[model samples]
Target chain A: MKMFPFVRGNKGNLVGCPVPNAGYSMTINIGCARRSLHGRYFGRGFDSHRLHQFSKGGDDSLTDKVDETISKENPTLDQIRTVKKSMSGAISDSVLKVSKLAIKDGFQVYEAIINLVKDVAMKSARIYMVFKRIEEDGNQIIFSEPSVVDIEKENFDKTVKLFIITKKSTSEIESTISNISEIESVSVEKFTAEGYQTEIPAVASILPPNSPVIKVLLVKIGDQTYAIAISNIERLISLDSQNVKTIEKIEIASVEEEIIPLLDMRDYFGNVKISNARQNAVIVEHESVKCGLVVDDFIKKDEVTVKTLGKIFKNAKEFCGGAILQDDSIALMMDIPYLVEKFSQVLKINVNIGQQHDI
Target chain B: MTFKITHEPFDVLTFKLGEKEYAIDVGITEMILGKCKIFKVPNSPDFLKGIVNLRGEIIPVFDLKSMINLEDRENSCSNVIIVKIDADKTGFLVDEVTEIMSIRSEFTTMKIVSANYIKGAIIKQNRLISFLDLQDLLVGKMSAFELGGKVG
Candidate 1:
């Protein structure tokens, strides 16, 4: 509890008196560092030094000033604090407090950002280490066996496990670690052959390759099975109930309330004959514009693995990729965005509401 | 005219279209699958027989008889050569798969009736078997007939 004396200066600015004998120069320097950090990192217009002086004064008149500055800086500072807490390791209170103050001054974490959400508390915190595999000249080196190395704990009181590695990206390690669960903390320590030690950090959550099971609506078109993302579908309407009108040479379906142009996928694919009359019309929305897809029959919705098409169909934008069905058959994944854009042009359907004057 | 065996014998998959026999490199032929149901595509070129689903892979079927400006004789052609061309798996519809005959590369000459897709001709079993470019016939080039238009 050191007292910092404030003196009123010209232009109503309160200047702090330099107490040389108080041995609080370090604290003043820390305050100055925080001010520079806040200005540089936070991009806020005001400085924290002035706010610190105003807060230390305990004057009722400057209370609004302190509150205003804190209110303005709290969101960004809290975000930084939250990220720091997400990092794998038990961060000391002094480090957290200092980091919070620094963050309030606008310290941004670039290389590593820890998400301090409820699920990522200290007990279940995930630790990640980033390693730089590539050099500037793009020379290659054989990767050490087992890319992920386990870290060891030295101090029993520490919640973080320290890992040592030679080379690998921090992001890659973070993604790999995120697939795992129920970890207290992780500390990645890198020791170069030159005896210099560097600490790289990362945060974790379930990443791609293992996650993101996509749901696609499988449809039977002729003898082919096609899949479209269910998210794109607005509603499934039976063809028997609606009268499809041909407007501007485009087949438009007038559902209960909305008028959507129907795109026959068989026509688009150039199938010679209709094996069966299309039973359902799937209203698809793309880029805020809605259209209908008439299909032979609707198959059950399934969560399948999406496989990208080979180079032959690289120019075929209509097919986004292919999905392997449970029965070991490939179903072409439809690119709704491409189909909507292409058919909309062919049918001369107006994309915007006001532009439908030609219709 | 027959030439000397200047090259080693290589296998060519022979198939019939209309009155002529066509041969394609065996490497390009996946399998000679019998005629399956072909779904006709409206507004597609006349040569396109529609599409066939083999197992789970949907392959676009092209009529070889139509490509060479020949009339479809009847429903006699019952075989489709499922060939891999570049990245696309396409089906080449033909009347019949005659046999796999080994012919020398030298015996196969590009002197057959000049066509964009016809590579040459090989004298196999006393018959002039036209070497057809299956890659060019199927997934290789986009012919005018393959152009899809708005359905009527």
Candidate 2:
């Protein structure tokens, strides 16, 4: 008997074989065989009587020659085996090259796989991802392993299906999977990705959940530790040797040609007299007003997690939030906009004129 | 005259001042902040200890001892009770929060008329607890503004 032929059957039936229609589907498990999942017709047509004759025929070459049945609705067992070999060859020739490049650049095999999937899925409207890894043996012959799937067929339904499982839009996932290398075809149902629990590993452990890492300038006044967002600071100026002039009761620090108003935070911290040594004036721009915050000392810049103050401290305008240091101490995070407004109200000194006379 | 007392129960926070225990309605108490830096506002009243930054709000803190004409003593640990009045908030310096007491209207017996701020006296656990009326406390003082006294 010629191994399963490429003959078209009815809509539901793929093989023109004489078998009970109820038990028609069968899965072929191959350990080292390169197989194409186009199980589309791999399981059809070959009845027990003919299968018995083909195994006993002793024509091993006939088992490997079915390459023409790529789109054949009723493909023979030999054609299915040939499709697997064809897919394995394509994977080794194209997909494996990209995977090797990613691996060489310090990316893990899994990460490379995710990136490849994302790249491929960007092109099509197929939301379901059905993938089979191709393994290359020592003889350089590529073989198909078992189908490795993150998503399944039941997920194709509109409710609690593919879209909801991945927490991604149907169109987005469809396009991504459609773009996968050597992917033949896809079928799906409408769905949603909202509130889906993702499997991707979160980036940093030190940062608070869902909060972005931010750089801040730490300033110490007396016993209090305060952090100002680095983006708000213009520069740090040393006032030890520079001739700091007090104009109109506001200390002035000369930087190039600009004179900025210097206000000591220690005055605001309390009546405690702390030694002002090795202190650098932090120059910050508030609205159009440029002012310097004279402090006791400057700690190195650090990345911190910002948490909002509780309702009890809701009225605290100068402090927008707080960050926990490595030592488990709370460092108050300054609200620059509010601080500037408060300084203008309390100091009675004009902010616009702080830029006038060149120190 | 026998006054009818309402059966509704309310909570009050009791704290120590000198040798006496004072109570404030828990409804008006916003928070109990730990020791913090209190900046002294210039030209303020003597009862106004200073202004402390609770979170970021600058609230005037009043010395409870001096506010009631008692001898001012050094508070080893400065615990501030942030209270809301009308629409504003102010902080009052206290030694520490003693306990929370649930009291009915019938528990309050005598109303002190010497100062309008004193609501009445109530006996809790065999000790006399005086209730301080926050509204009258703010309105009675002409120098309340100097004490960071905000009406609300």
Candidate 3:
């Protein structure tokens, strides 16, 4: 019986296996296999009420090992230029820089790069409580939205591994297992490596089926789940000597609709335009300019009126206006002109994100 | 209220989907490649046409025609204009090679959507062109290759 061949290791999760019409699916429940997440996060001695200051995201242990795995390969600029030609001008220079740095540092940062994650911000402490079954989704089910019960952050970074799951519905729970991303390691039950019937010890986990085509690898961060989609799963894998714990359980959360993907883009070309820019960001409109500047993000909207904060940013590169937000955080209103001039020397225009293929 | 391009001329690199014309600011137009090999990825977002290898890097391309609720036309014109517009590394596939137009100033170019994030539309070739409205194009879509953001 060549089932999807992959099955969650824990027996409890196996109870939820092979959902109706869902072929090649199996769930296993390893109860509290790594449920010390609260102590790993909240137990940290640092005390801070802020998000960014406390936002040193992820228990970066195993990932650190993974990052270190590719340390020996010293990728060169010339190699990148050659790859770009193969990439047919899709890889942005910013992304290439990161790729080079990753190759130099022996890690891959360009993959699974989650940013601006506000919904699950510093409120990780609250999520910690949910891990203890103190909270549940709107349904009164006890294990509803099942969270990690005992996983900690340190154990995550030190010992966690990864695996792949494929073909899951949007925003729908992949498995009965709660929080699939937080588990440390897994076994390849029904996977084919290099077109061979081979099973590798998976360092990550995916939702199954959907990830098969894109080649996504799901990894655990503290007690959260994130997907790493790419073409070459091998180029993305990093080897670590540290032994992380096997996954106990995952809450299997789905990427929601209307969820905004965060950009790693900083200020581009200091020119701004004052149009619908009031929403996410403002565009600086100059009378003689051909292309205006685009602010990376919107800190605020509809405060007072459309006016600059009397700040002259002629020499300043990215920002022009300095307006205080309602939260009292001073946002440097971006200057598009200066930014463009600053980056004018850069090899502009390349797609740095995901899915690489050869045509 | 009227605004003129006298402030500045923003060059919008426009493209055609089937026979209709659409445009986005050239700033967001990352790569305008002509006719690459595209592979069909199962269970992707409906708008996503398939994946392509520029060289070794694989990029997911979206069909602008299919995105606008238009019917799929077989073998009309298969020129994929891969636009890496946002953080998602998404590609928008347009049909045929149309010239890039620099839009002069006009405030009425923006078309209004009925209660959606679509802010406005632009007029091209005398026809009311509904621009990609990138903000709206991305609003409800989930991330790539993830569950719910992927195909079941």
Chain B TM-score, one value per candidate, order as shown: 0.81, 0.83, 0.72
Q: Pick the candidate with the highest TM-score.
A: 1
- Candidate 3 residues lying further than 4 Å off, grouped into runs, are A1-359, B1-8, B72-75, B86-90, B107-119, B143-152
Superposed by TM-score, candidate 2 places the C-alpha of residue A7 at a distance from the truth, in angstroms, of: 99
Clashes of 2: 20
In candidate 2 chain A, what residue range of length 10 has the lowest lDDT sum? A134-143
Model 3 residue B123 distance off true place after TM-score fit, in angstroms: 3.2
Docking level of model 3: incorrect
Best by lDDT: 1
Candidate 1 off by > 4 Å = A1-213, A220-225, A239-261, A264-279, A304-316, A322-332, A343-359, B1-8, B27-30, B34-61, B82-91, B104-108, B136-152
**Every candidate's CA RMSD:** 24.5, 29.3, 25.2
Q: Per-candidate TM vs. native?
A: 0.45, 0.41, 0.34
Ranking by lDDT: 1, 2, 3
DockQ of 3: 0.01
lDDT by residue for model 2 over A1-359, one digit each (tens)?
11121111111111211122322212211111212122211222111110101011222232233223323444422233334333321211111332233335433222111222233432212221222111110001111111101111111222111101222343554455456554444334331212222111101111122243468888876766778878778888787634677755567777889977677777755546565444577888767877788777788798876653332242344554565555555576766654564454323313212311221
Could you tell me how far off, in angstroms, the CA of residue A73 lies in candidate 1 after the best superposition?
A: 42
